[model samples]
Target chain A: MKPRGWKELNPGAVITEAGSARKFKTGSWRSFKPVWIEENCIQCMMCWIYCPDMAITAKDGKRGEFNYYFCKGCGICALECPGKKGKKAIVMEEEGQ
Target chain B: MSASRVVAVTGNESVAEALRQVNPDVSAAYPITPATDIMQRFTHYVSNGKVKTEMILVESEHSAMSACIGASAAGGRVMTATSSQGLALMWEELFIASGYRLPIVMSLVNRALSAPINIHCDHSDGMGARDCGWIQLWSENAQEAYDNTIQAFRIAENMDIRLPAMVCMDGFIISHSIERMEYLDDDAVRNYVGDFKQLYPLLDIAHPVSYGPLILSDYYMEYKRAHAEVMSKVKHVVLDAASEFERISGRKYGLFEDYRLDDAEIGLVVLNSAAGTSKDVVDAFRDRGIKAGLLKPRLFRPFPYEEVGEALKHLKAVCVLDRADASGASYGPLFMEIASSVSPYSPRPVLLNKIYGLGGRDYLPGHAESVLSELAEVAATGKVRTFKEYIGVRE
Candidate 1:
């Protein structure tokens, strides 16, 4: 969005709209992305429960891919995956790789 | 004029009287010297049921100001009082209150800052917070203090100028001294300030508005610029409020009080109680054909620069006496502002700065007379021996 001038800004910078945080894309803040390995996935829903930003999308008793629009990848999903050794359900990778 | 009762009261008591008339919805304050009596008296009103204000006794000035911000955001008329260290402690929250455009009125009993640890009157406290974005109304005596405190509510709460305001009175000088002043009728004050209305009240669940949101570089400057623009409108709002107040109280007010400055060769600019002292001295100088005058600034914060400049432009020379020093700075806070006000005019008055009366030092008529004598010399010779000096200091 284009920057607004003083005349165009709201009084006292008050944001009149509720839940406006959804408009801001914070995914760019992440340097690492968590990649899900579907073959090793137990669908235990650990990542969905642990995602601080609510970035891990989930369905009825099932999990979906990371919602990068809101994800600020902290690698907590890969750390808490509980998948054994090299066959981990989630792993971290550099972005744009 | 509306019915008013004449009574002798201290500055703190007068301000408390105004508060009783205002009967703010909430008050949260932690006391400091010279200012404690104001809140103490206010709490008495609360206990005796003279006012229906909710008193929130806080642990510190910071918490007090924070609570005031909360209450003000919740669409309540809020007030508090403090001095010196108490004001310094509330520094960060002061900005937040004004940034949110809360019309919280505060009684700032001007006192000296600590370190040397003096408990006395000084401009250091109010001058320190001069740029905190709140409107400042300085008083010369107990009467002015009372009047200003009453007017502050109307000025700050005006829809076009919903900014917090601080009514400043000298610490021990005026706060403790008893003087005769009139108290406007309770109903008269109520009608004057009128009912409080808030635009996006936090208490209103029907329409929610986010306050104090984090606006990044994309819009931070615009928000600040808007804030600045609003301050530019304060001077007009203050005059409007003052005129309305005059109809009810029969007392005139202006951005700054001009005492015989109309046709003067030399003048003096001072603030708070010192202005009262200098007024008498100006009268004495005038009697002797010195053509002296004085300008006492009442609405100091969006300082009426153009008005001040126009008022003093005709004088040959002018001296700005400050009650506190700016320490490492070249001149006192008031002096810098007065200098800036007259900077645009051609063939301007010869300006001088005087730092005096720190830690409640006596601002005697002799001190004022000496400063006027110096100004007289400068006006005569069109030269200044010293641009700035400390007056009433021991050699």
Candidate 2:
């Protein structure tokens, strides 16, 4: 209903150039976040390689973990992964997109 | 990288092959000359079922981008291509693509933006879209054309990087040139690009999510704030994709690249196919003991501000060459962005704006010599100018 902008609460946007912080445009969470299904992931490591932000993570020794720290929540992996649908292991959820 | 082995696909065909590589679900287009060939290739793919995607032929470029936003919102990988007046027509939907953060990837043929009207190549068409919040990339050749299209999808589709991108290549030259290009095999491209699953598909009847909701002033600034935040994702996306594209294509590149500039004191900023010409000129300059080098722009829209500024930081004279004129401004749009990038820094190098190749005017060897001569003058004068003479123009 309203536009997204900078806030004291969120990390907000980065100051690309010099000068004081400009007015906030929108709060991020407007984008989307991706959720991963642990059981279905075969840990092919494709998500990490193809991830533009390198947002995917691996578990300690066990492997197959995604920190989702910087994940915009694009479901490319979940949708393309063999485990999708009845066995969708990685699903996209709405967050600070 | 060896230029001899380069493939000779037209700019439009590059878009068609790029569509196959990017692998979108819904493709639409309203063709213009030079750019029409792009939709042609896409049509063949759709008919042959090689791409396995919907090829929607729209009535106009405006509807093409709007339909793209809808398709992207509905969670389909989408693509389109246009040039000159067609791009001018799509201006409104261009902003809509960014506002909705649809991450739509379109191809611009880098034709001269019309007034007196020319079908030839220039930055006017692409520069007009500068403030639209889409990532812009210019290709030196058809390979970069193919390469940027795939990386554009990777950049636009990333959540933090969910903005649109216009992968620009010269309309007639690179678009029409027939060279030997190593086309990426479908499976390998599929493996490299993976699939574009939408962040949250708007069409899912069960899970209703918001997209381009009405934004009052309060919230409007915030989404724009996030838009700024999302561009940071570009540094990562470009680097990551460039690395892989290089591995496959074997010609490594960055957002902005320096040719013969490693130790040169003179900097010439340029974009598109002109970079190839500039490289030869730089060699001739070096033979004459003039250290003039080139700062070729790879990514125009995101502006690649930091890389460009840093590259020119050590130069004695930084000549900003613009292919498109910005009417009343200091010079062309690219020159302005360069000047502003180094605006705050003191003892800044000199910036000279040289407008060349309007209405498809050619920048030949004699023109290159004159450009270098002017650089010699600026290096000797130390005066910072917002404008300079047009190179190789007829009286």
Candidates' lDDT values, in order? 0.92, 0.75
What shift in Å separates residue A1 of candidate 1 from its native position after superposition? 3.7
The list of candidate 2 runs beyond 4 A from truth reads A1-97, B1-7, B381-386
> What are the runs in model 1 whose C-alpha is more than 4 Å off?
A42-44, A83-88
- Residue-wise lDDT of candidate 1 within B317-388, one digit each (tens)? 999999889999989999998999999998899999999999988989999999999899999888889999
Estimated TM-score for each candidate: 0.96, 0.78
Candidate 2 residue-wise lDDT, B1-395, digit = tens:
21223355665676688787666899878989778888888888789887778888889989998899889888898888899999999999898887677778888888887677789888788888888888988888887788788778877777666778889988787888865666766666676677787766777756655555455675567767767766666777888878877776676878888888878778788888877788888898899898888888887767777777777777777777788888887577888888988776777777788888876788776666667677777788865454576766768
- List-wise, what DockQ does each model earn? 0.75, 0.05
Clashing pairs in 1: none
Best by lDDT: 1
Candidate 1, residue B280: lDDT:
94
Q: How well is candidate 2 docked (DockQ)?
A: 0.05
